[model samples]
Every structure is written in C-alpha cells, then in structure tokens.
Target: MKRIPIAAAALILVALGLGLLDLGLLDLGTPDRERFRGMVSPRLQSDKSSDTAPTIQAAGPTYVGRQTCLECHRENHRLHSHHGHATTFRSTKDPEVARRFAGKSYDAGEPFGTYTYHVDDQGLFVRIPDKFGDRPFRLEYALGHRSMTLISLLPDLQSDQDTPRSDRDTVALEHRVSWMASEGQLGKTPGQHDGPPQTAAELFGHRHEGRIMHRCVYCHVTTGEIVGQQIVGLTPNVNCEKCHGSASEHVRQARTMKTPPPFSVGRVDWDAESELQLCGDCHRMPRDITRKQLREYPDLLARFQPVGLLRSECFVQSGGSLKCTTCHNPHQSIDETTETEHEQNCIACHDETTPSTETSRKHTVCPVSPTTGCIACHMPALKLDGLGDGFHDHWIRVRDDK
Candidate 1:
C-alpha cells in the first residue's frame, strides 16, 4: 500500500469525522452546527423569553368603553354596529326590545296559565296569572338583536338588595318566554323545550335565574368585569376592544404620540394555534364542548361555526391557511350576498383545473360544476330548529347525499 499524500490523508480524516458526527458517534461542537440547532429548535429560547415576560399586575388598565374607541375608529365602529354581535346584549331601552314586546302576550294555557308581555314607560313587564295569582316580573335586558328568536332577560330577584349601588349586584335572570321573529310570535326559549311548568305551583315558584350576567354576558358584551357575583363595569356590546383585548394601553400610547405604538392586543402576529384559540374562545370550538353535549344539543352546533370548521377535512388539509377571517371581516357585518366571493375562497385551495388522465396523482374535483358556487353544496345552509334561522355550516365537506 503506497503512502497516501498528506492533503489526501487530511481530506479522508475530515470525511470520517463528519460521518461519525452524523451517526452521533462523535461530537464536533462546531459553532455552525450550534447555530443550526438554535435555528431548528427555538422552543428553548421561546420558553426562556415567555418565562421572563411581564405578567398582569394588580389593578391593571380599566375599561374606557366603546365610545372612546369610536373617537378614533369611526368607520370600523359604524360597520361593527351593524353586526349581530354588537347588538346581542342590550338594555330594555333598546328600540328593538320595545318592538318585540309591543302588544305581544303569550297565553301559556294549563299549569303556566296566561302570561302577558307588555312594554310601557316603566319598561318591559311579564304579567303571569296562575292559581298562585298575578305576578309581574320586570324585564331588564334583551339577549338578541337580528336573530329570529330573542331571549328576554329579567332582573335577578335573588341579587336584588337595598345595599349601596357599588355593593349591589347587577344580575339578569332568563325568562322562559322568548320572542320568535320568524313566526312573529312568542314561544318557549331555546333549551327550555320541556313545555313550561308542569303544575300551577311550579309555574309560580319557578325562578329561572340562569345567571345571564356571569355565565354568558362576557361573550355578548365587551370588557365585562364581574366581581363576586356583581357586575362592576360592563360595556354591553361587542366593541373594538373585545377581539383586540383591553385597549387601555393602546389608548394611553395614542394620546401621548402622533404615531402611537402598534397595538399588541390580539395582534395578527399570533401563531395559527393562537389565532384559532382567540376566535374559539367565543365561537365554541371542539375544546369548548364535549362529544356527548354536542350530540344531545345538535341544534346548538349550528351557532358554533369554529367547532364545525375545525372538524372539516378541508380545514385539516389546509394546514392553517383557512380561518374565520379568511372569509369574514371581524370589524364588519358578514356580507350574505358574497356567494361568488365565497366560491373564490374555496377555489383558492381546490383549483378548477381539470386533472390529466395520464397523471398518477389527481386532486379531488367538485362533483357538481366546478366553476359554479361551491358553498351551496359543500356548506349548505342548515336551519337551526332552536333559532329558526338558516346558518351556513362552516364544515366544508362533499354532500353527495344531499
């Protein structure tokens, strides 16, 4: 064996060392390798950064209300006002509430007996007459604006006290009778399908305190602060800060500088999972509801678009491209007349190009006309029995059975 050249021998040694390193049998500890490792595995750095991030201190920024936001974002405020979310929770003073209860009386015969819904200068009153005698409950809030059905919210009798206003709890009790806009009539409220009270005594004693303020008010209202059963501060509308988080810091920044710092609350810089969770908080994602609850309350699923969309094969395959904001502008009311626009969103992933017969790999084509609207078939409008409104299912799937 002839002795190899020094240069050749050096090259062989380097290659052998690299091979051993690749096989994890040797450690080079090179700066380049360390940099590559840092780039690929950033969780270690992220964990450290997150650990040191400033947490919410005691008595943070206070809610300034939607009017403060409207001063700067007039156009956005105007558009959001038309959204159903903005009008979901309202005081009895709202004109829509008056329209709903105007001369409307639901005569719930038998055990419940006759119940009259009346709106006057004193506000909404539900006069219930049974074997126990006539008792009128004051309705304080309305739970919906544009939906076919609107749930009435009465003042919580349990929470009613002669204590100081600051000490008193402002709570809402759900009324059994709900206004149905579609049929232009009053019927049993959603989830109360058991057909009123069983007996006359039960009707009189029924105190359906669903805890509307604590249980569901947070979603409907913006910056709702509940402290020990009492609602301290609440802006009864889905305002600018609701999705964007508390705008107190942003407002402070804006006041001092001509060009304020970028508002960090609910920033678009969030990761896909973070973005999903943000919307999922209110939209009722899969994590929010159990399989048993979903099966039992199938009608409730119609309202939970995020839950349905997350379950869709399209959403799974899209790998984070598809989101609520993909088709909807959160600041504005959803445009129902955007059939062509909606079809374009579907076409973004599902190209209309015909597959070649010779090609081994082929994409799934729309069984119906590819050029036409895809949503009509894939995400058909499903009528919710509870609300009596047709909600387009966000779950994008082939519905050949339909």
Candidate 2:
C-alpha cells in the first residue's frame, strides 16, 4: 500500500470540498449520505480518533441491533426516547404519504377517491394486502427506514409494490413503471420509472422480499439481515446494534458492566476499529467482487464497495487531506436520519471557516440556503425507471444534471 504525501492529500481534500474532483462537470446535489452533504445536518467527524488501545483478538457473534441489544439496557431507550430512528413500524401519520400514494394521479386507474382500502401491496417482511377495488393491491410499510432517529417516506412507488400468493405458496412478483432517482445525484430527480425490463434480474428482481443485500437493506432499514427460516423471511427494523457495534456484549456490559472491563460499550474509544466497524460496515458501499449470500443474507464485510472512495487518491494525497471522518459522522442524522446525513455533513466542513475541518481551511463560497446545499449543485437527483426510481448516483462527481 503506497502512502499519500501529507501536502497533496490536503489539496485534494479541499478540492473535494469545492466539488473540484470531477472538474465541475457533474450535478452535486444527490444527497447520498455515504459521500457528500445534504442530509440537513452537521458533518459527522469521520476523522481518526487519537485514542489508542490494545486490539481485541476475538471476533464476536453476528449481531442484529434489535434482539441482541434491546433485551439488556431498557434505560438507554430513555436517551433514545427522543430519537427518530428509535421510532419504526407504526401507522402512517403523515398525510403526505397518503397524497404521494393516493394523489399520484397516474392513469394507472386505481380510483383514488371512490375507493376503500385503495392500496395494499408489499412490505420488507412478507405481507398480503387487499385492494378496495379492481386495481391490484399494494402493501405499504407505514414506515420505510428510520434515520435521524425518525421515519422517512419511500419516494419510489415501486419500493413498496408487491403481488399476491396463490395456492402453491407462489407469489407472482410484478414489475412496473415508476419515477426512480439515484442515491446521490438530483438532476431533475430523473424519472426512474423509465427503464426496460429486459433482464430477469431487473424485471423480477424485487417481486418478493428480493434478497435484501448491500443495495437493498440500507434504504429500508438499518442493520438488516436474513433470520428465521431462510425462505419464509426477514426481520426489518431500526436495530440498535447497527451503531453501537453488535450490542450483544454492549448489552451484557450494560447489565453487569463487563464487556470492556472498566469501559463498557457506551464509552466509545474513537481510536479502535469498533467505531469504524459498525459504520464502515455500511457507509463503505459494495465491492465489484463480494461474498456469497447464505440463505439470501449477505456478508456485509465481504461486500463493502466504498463507492466513490478512492484509496489511491487518499494515500497519494497529504496526510490531513481527508479522513473517512471528514465527511461522515456515524452518530448523526440527515433529512432527519441519524445513520448518516450527507447534505448537512458538507456544511460542517464547507462553511466560511470550516471549524470542524481537520486538514485545511476553505474560503466560504456558496450561500447557506437549501438550494446552495452541497448536494443541491453536485449530487443532483436523476429520476429513471431503474433500481432506485429517483436515486442520486454515488459517484461523487461535479457535472451537469444530465
């Protein structure tokens, strides 16, 4: 592994902050939390912590945040009582969700007004909903994914779409047109519902609980995986361990105060991989090559893809150029999501006198307005009838919104 010179790395870090890496050619408003700003929060100190401790030799059991952690400390829930991610699986309170669904006046003809139970389709977990009228039913998870410790609405109509199961326990998954957007860019929020269903993977890929792996789980829920009977399932929720590092021990530590001897899981040693592991576990993206899915569950570590992350660039640049922590803070939220918030993450380091910045200082340029959000100009959303109906690309470039 080649190392980056401390000086050049510093320049690139500033360049990235100015949306100069891609030469000012790509729309920067995608709001992809993994990379740049726009989650509407402060930057999450992704910088390496100065603390150092002996590395733990053992690898613990695989943990899912809910079952593994919730059982132990019922008190922390008090602290999180105010957290939004802490809230998941409830009936819809936002009338906006109703409008987004019912008011979507598309000519698909489902009778928005004169209908009872107008929609009933699919959920992250298996579900069957009955339609009020002749239109095919669609199931809706009252809540999509929790971040900012709160609930976010699934914008892509197809994300919650599902079909019916017949006598043989077989459900014919249906694919349809939808306005999709990339995870990072926002160019006109491209109509993601405009692609051809030529391939089997593309057409029937999400008919059912279509193997929620790398690209799937993060969007729906934090810390998701296959549990229960492989074919019959998935337990989706804003699990606790997703952030605190497999709370099994953390929980045990809380009960008896013993996991890390004197310092329990709550005392995060920013120096250890513990902080990075839980986060890099997800923010790191998928690799071109990855682990095999066991019973539809993926080995997150084996599949990390750090999308726009260029290790070579980081290594060759100056030491303070940029650290993973520079743009992301695992403990924060965006657009109300706590897992990560890109749009606001940038503001932390891009402001007039970037206070939280570790590498260098930048002269403030853009006005502090919603439209001037880092992502508003760089990662602009592009809508297409693709995997993410209206996703922002994760490429982290500076270009036109086309």
Candidate 3:
C-alpha cells in the first residue's frame, strides 16, 4: 500500500495498541505506562489504607424512652394508651389498683386460710394468717387492669444467693392470690391450684423469679432490662419501642436534620411470617407448643390466636396472605367493636367471584356459604375456663352443624 501520512500512521498504531490492551493481549508495565493507566482509571487513585484498615463504623442505637416517641406519634400514643397491653403492668401506687382493691377481702377456709386485702396510705397490703398470727405483706405492683383478672406482685421471697435486697437487687414475684372480675371474687392464681396448708414461708415457695422475669415480665412490660438480679429502667406497660426497635439513632438523625438510614430504628422489611413471629414472641404459637401439650391444653388455644390461626385451613390455603393486622388493629383494644369489620376482611378474599373468572383472579369464593357472615360459624367464640368471657377462636374452619 502507498505510504500513509505521518499523523494517520500514528493514529492507526494507537488504536491498534488500545484494541490489543482491551483484548488482554498486551501488558504495559513500564513506569510511564502505569502512571498513564492511573490517570485513566479512577479506581487506581483510591486510598490503599481503605483496603487494609479496619472500619470504624458507629455503634447501634439504644432505646430512647416512649415519651420521646410520643413527641411525634401522639394519636398512636393516645390509641395505644387505651389498649389492654398498655395497662398490663402497673405500680401498686396507681389509683386504679387502689380502686379495684378498695375494701375488698378474700377469705379461704381451713387448709388454704384467709387473707384480708386493704389499701391504705401505707400501701396495698394483704393480712395473711400464719402460725405467729396475721402478718402483712406489702404489694408493690399490680398485673392486669381487672377487665378479666388482677394479680399482685410481691417482693421476691427467694433472692439469688446472698444478694442483699437493695432497690437495684429487688425482683417482684407473682402472688398466689388473684381476683377474677368475671366471677367478682378472689381465687387461687390461675396456674396455682387449691391445696393443703403449708408454712407461711412455703406459701410462695413455688415462685421462680428469674424464670418469671425472663419469660413473663419481659413481654408484659415495655422495656424490661434485667441487669444481674435487678430490673433496670423498665416501663410498666408495652409502648412504642416494644414493637419498633430502639429509636436513639432515628431521633438523633431527626435532631441533626439528616435522613435516617433504612432500618435505623427497627426492621422495616418484615414479611408475613416475621410479622406473625413478632406477635408470636409473646402470644405463643403452634411452633412453641408440642402435640402432647396441645392435646392437654386445647382450651389454651383461645389465648394464643397465632397458634389457632396457624392451625386454620384459611391460613394454610392463603399461603400467608392473611396476617394478624388483616382483621385486628394492634393500635386499638381487642373487643366487639372490631367483630363487625371482620366480615369485610373475610369477603375481600372469599367473595362471590371465582379465581378462574376475570373479575377476581387471585382468590376463591367461600365454598360453603358465601353470603353468610364468616365469624360466627367459622370462628365461633370459645370460652376459656379462667380467662373470663369467650374469645373468638382464630381458627377459621367449617362447622358441621352450621
């Protein structure tokens, strides 16, 4: 070929070199070449210390109190304040506790003995008859709002090894006596049975304070932090942070005028199963029960809606399309007010339209009776023996008679 111009020849050589480099057929490692490579590639300029040095990321957030949460969520706070969960645990000094126990005395015959309940300026006291005579035990806390049952919290009779009873070391034990509002009478605590008399010291001997603190108190109260033998900084009732994780980081971000990162306060991407598990942590689910336990305590299913709902065909068929929030609002009290609204929720999935049809492609109509209300027949109210009124069974199933 004819000799090309000097500029055109230089351009052709540069393009050929670049093409060979791109094809990994050339290795240019000279000092001048490496410096040129650094100029072209931005990643080459990245600090080498970044690759070897340890990351100094900030620590996870801590729990800021519920009052901090109430600053922004007043309506939710107001609605939640009226929920049964909000009043599950209360200091004995609360006026409501005093009103419930005012002038009330419970007397048991022979073996069990008699006890007189009285609330005075001194505090709530139960005078129990022992060998020495009637002795007074001061009640420190009250469990339940008396809508169903109310029980007292007594000072821990059994402390861990020689730990002195300091304010920091104090633990509350569930008392043996409980008031059942449905019957308008006091009875032996729900789990405890009526038995022969024992020494005054042995009366609350069955109390497992540590186990109760770990299993029961942790769920009943909002934030129960047990440091050693002491419960440090516990909120008496369930509050916002109980569901949403600690919001210290979130609050800090808001104060600093910065957008908080994802899941800065709590997990935001909870699937249906995880949401159920969050509620199940306290409510108890089928996975928490054994077959033998289920058989022995079938009536307890009323208290555990998650377990009952998991057993239902509706839940199994829907592939987790239904959740607790689908029919019940966690922000509100659980009562008859929500009962009428459940039919609408049921109809959303089980209406007249068939899955094969164009109108409703995803759900099937109720095979038994589409027109009838879903609750009464499918989820009939089952009375829990000691739990007062009937609790509608969350197990959605067909009733033979209906």
lDDT of 2 at 109: 22
Name the candidate, 1 or 3, with the larger lDDT value: 3
Winner on lDDT between 1 and 2 is 1
**TM-score, each model?**
0.71, 0.41, 0.74
- Model 2 ranges off by over 4 Å: 1-105, 109-219, 222-235, 258-305, 311-325, 336-402
Using TM-score as the measure, the top candidate is 3
Model 2, position 267, has a per-residue lDDT of 44
Writing each residue's lDDT as its tens digit, candidate 1 over 1-402 gives 122232331221111111112222111112132232222232233345655765452234445677788888898778887887778777775777777776777776654656676777877776664433345556666777654223333333334466534223333334557777666677766543244333322332222222323446666777566554444576787776655655676687688998875553334455555556656666656655555644664544656788778878877765665688777877777654378877777665566463434422234667667777687787887777656665777777776556
| Root-mean-square deviation (CA) per prediction | 22.8, 17.2, 25.7
Which ten-residue region of model 3 has the weakest summed lDDT?
12-21
Candidate 1 pairs with clashing backbones: none
Candidate No. with top lDDT:
3
- Greater lDDT among 2 and 3 belongs to 3
How many clashes (backbone atoms < 3 Å, residues ≥3 apart in a chain or on different chains) does model 1 have? 0
Order the numbered candidates by lDDT, best leading: 3, 1, 2
